[model samples]
Target chain A: MAEPHLIYFADPMCSWCYGFSPVIAEIRRAYGRALPIKLILGGLRPGTTEPMSQKARDELAGHWTHVQEATGLPFNRAAIDGEGFLYDTDPGARAVVRVRREDPELALTYLGRLQAAFYGEGLDITRPEILADLAAEFGIDREAFLADLDSRDLKQETWGDYGTSQRAGVTGFPTLVAGPNQDGAYGVVTRGFAPGDQVLAVLNQWIEGAVAQH
Target chain B: MTAARRLPLLAALSLSALLAACATTPPPKPLSQGRGAWSFAPANRSESAKLAYGIPNSDDVGLMLLCAQPRVKIWMSQPAAAPPKKIALRSGKAHGVYPLAPEGEALLQATMPAADPVLDAFAASGELIADQTRLDARAANERAAIRAFRGACPAKTR
Candidate 1:
């Protein structure tokens, strides 16, 4: 029997997913080897044309507040309040995809750095230059990363990841689904932000169930 | 106390009160509940819909529509309750109860018929009415969002 796969559908720009980062780290420590984890972008606010409205700004600030209260994750209010900040998340998602393709090992680390840069430090991650700078910080080749980011193929793959999120019936970020493979039957362990211990318990249950089925 | 000492103490209290007030303020309503615009990406034929919509700022709740064979599956951020087996969905004169099913712990779904009339009715309706929640998907971009969804996962020919 093949080992079950745990797919994490999230966006680097999602505040809730940022809050769930510590929990994800704990899950990684507990089940990293036992269950292979796949990270896919959920494509939040991708392809957005208009600048975010003032109302939208207020709404997101409230969410950041809630996430900070719930998860104790630091958030910079200035990021959302910054002028002309369009919340298009495609650039950040594409950067993660590029890193995943080039250096799969650094993909998750790259995602964390992007989240920290955006939510914690209030850095605008919608720009390719910003993403490349962060990539350089992670020791990834900056120019090659930019080339992959602008490639037609990467755009298609990132869009494909959005479609994957839709087909997986994922409505929110930080969704964790466990299954046999990309094509095989999968079950959602949790959706939205959850504590590490709670997610681990569900993972253990699913692992036990998979074993029993075998 | 000296006026200088009282000034600092008063400033501290006022600042604390202001922070508390900001924290206690109710969250803003989701953009979907109002006349907010939504954008749709170009559809991908290999999978389901390549669209995204949510109540802005309510990070935990979102609505996703996927095209499956013979039916369009709708998923919401809200969890499914055991009762309310059926939900009445209406747009304009076309109204029906989409059978609600539990997709996962944090998601609920209602599968609508994929026939043209059903899809057209939903597309043409100014608002999607279900109980007290009304989703305004009648805007030009919202309609495009729906079109992209249907285009991605069209019904298979028999």
Candidate 2:
């Protein structure tokens, strides 16, 4: 019998994932020791050149509204509607990867804080400088964070994270997959944003099943 | 400039601080609506399928389908009491009414045509909207989803 692991596929710019942050935190709290969890970046909008159009912004605002209504998460409408705001998510995704490499434990915290900084405070998370600042606020060294952010290798590594997510059959942000072990075949546990309790219930079942099988 | 004026000013400051604190705190647990729980089983070896069953943030009851194998299949769960008379899928240049079939207890599934042009169009689109009688839902991050589906299940060469 192999140890089962949980993988979470998410994007920082994804609003639903932002709503699921608190729930994910709770999962980590309860099961962090029992199950080794891996976080992979699902690139939502990478290499997007054009600035967000009004129609796109309006549609995204509607999504934010829905998430807020369902989860009570706060969102900054002004930042979303601000002029010249590009919706590219690659920079933020790459920042998470960088954090994951530097401090594995801080990676999730950085992701949560980044979500809060973007959706909650209306900060532009797509900019490398802004991301570096956020990293510093999370106790990461600012200069080193910037240097790593600009490294060609890190960019490729970020793309690699996206590739891993795609290979794992993750189509949406905040997807959770369960596997027999860290290196085994994975089955989708939950896709899209789910509440903490619902996720835990399903995970608990999986844990019990694994125990029974062994 | 008297004590009374100072008292009101201090009270206003305290209220502002309290509101700011409230704004920063994380939200409470969401009300239980029986949304967001799913189970998974391996698909047939020849064809790969990833099914997500639960209430998505947007719809009442939702199931997301990603299939790769003979061709590409992307299904967004719809709210139909009975199977709809017509089903249509439209993106940027890829627009067509697809043949619908029931998937399990709920969900109507459709496979995109295997032609290169159709697959290409679907892959390039930013969003895909599926429509049926009294139900409509859009899939975001569509390009990534299409790419993942294609990578996992490639079209078989005829």
Candidate 3:
């Protein structure tokens, strides 16, 4: 028999995942340690090389507007407007992986901060220094986080999460999966963004269903 | 193996490999209430029809179809951008080709006229393919929904 837990497949650079941050927080507040939620970076745009075309950047800005309207999340659309910016998601994902190495408990909290910094504040998370600055806020040594974020091994490990997400059939961001109960079966909580209330209702039912198995 | 037998054996192995590749492709998430089905949003007084191929009222959808009669538009979610800017649609004998444009980070889009035979094939055919990715194909009642939507909205007001 395996313990019931949640796995969140998300990317810090994904706008929808940024929108879903509050809902994940609600889940944590409600369930606490009873339902441990694991975070996995979905690598939405890892290692992107091309400088975004103006049209592409405009499209991204439109998406941020839609996200803001739907989730009431603040977004700095100018983030995509910078000159010749490479929208690579690898470095941001590595920061979370490095933090997870230090303390599993800090992963989710740190992820939320990164989302807020990127979408909310328009900080360039693709840069190591930006990632290091965020880590310092959590009392994580800035120098160590940069070293780990820059290390090839950490990049490989962070990418491993992307592979896990693909193997698990997660095609969209903010995908939440729960389970491996006594029968070793799992169920999807939400494959995309859901209202916090709807997510809580599902979580409540999952808890009931798991308890019923007892 | 003799040459005749070797040729047949090779063909068999290649066919199996193609089938396996298609089978290994991940399934697209359903847009409406039921998996393996398309859900149509209520068509207002207008002649345009908007249908979603993923979850209802959610931003994370697999496909979205917007039809206003002789013209039909499709927005598909893609995992990555392809180099080519055209979408080739295939369903059995029916084939449709359209210019493909990226709508956003994960969405690729194409437009076609309603009079196009490919639209009919999409409504009746049990399978669909766009570019290299396989879309949700089924014989569920949602096929009727798609037909109704196509009927109510023809690219030009009928």
User: Candidates' DockQ values?
Assistant: 0.04, 0.04, 0.05
lDDT for model 2: 0.62
Candidate 3: fraction of native contacts reproduced: 0.04
TM-score of each: 0.60, 0.59, 0.72
Q: Residues B31-132, candidate 2: write the lDDT tens digits.
A: 333234332334665435554444465222244545555555545443211235445755556677767644322234566655434445545653444562
Models ranked on lDDT:
3, 1, 2
Which candidate model has the greater DockQ, 1 or 3? 3
Q: Which fraction of the native contacts appears in each prediction?
A: 0.05, 0.04, 0.04
Worst 10 residues of 2 chain A by lDDT: A205-214
Q: Put down candidate 3 lDDT per residue, B1-158, tens digits, no spaces.
A: 43323333333333222222332222222222233246776666743577666543234456667775567777766453233467677767878888875443445578878677766776766456766655655546567776666666653464
Stretches > 4 Å off in candidate 3: A210-214, B1-88, B95-120, B131-133, B137-158
lDDT of each: 0.65, 0.62, 0.69
List ranges where model 1 is wrong by over 4 Å. A181-184, A208-214, B1-60, B63-158
Error of 2 at A38 (Å): 0.5
lDDT of 2 by residue, A1-214 (tens): 3444567788887788898889888776665544556788877666655676675577567658888987898899677677788777878998999999977668888899999889999989888898999898878899998888879999898888878865664545677776644334456666667777677666555443433343
Report how far off residue B118 is in candidate 2 (Å).
Answer: 9.7
Against the true structure, candidate 1 has what lDDT? Answer: 0.65
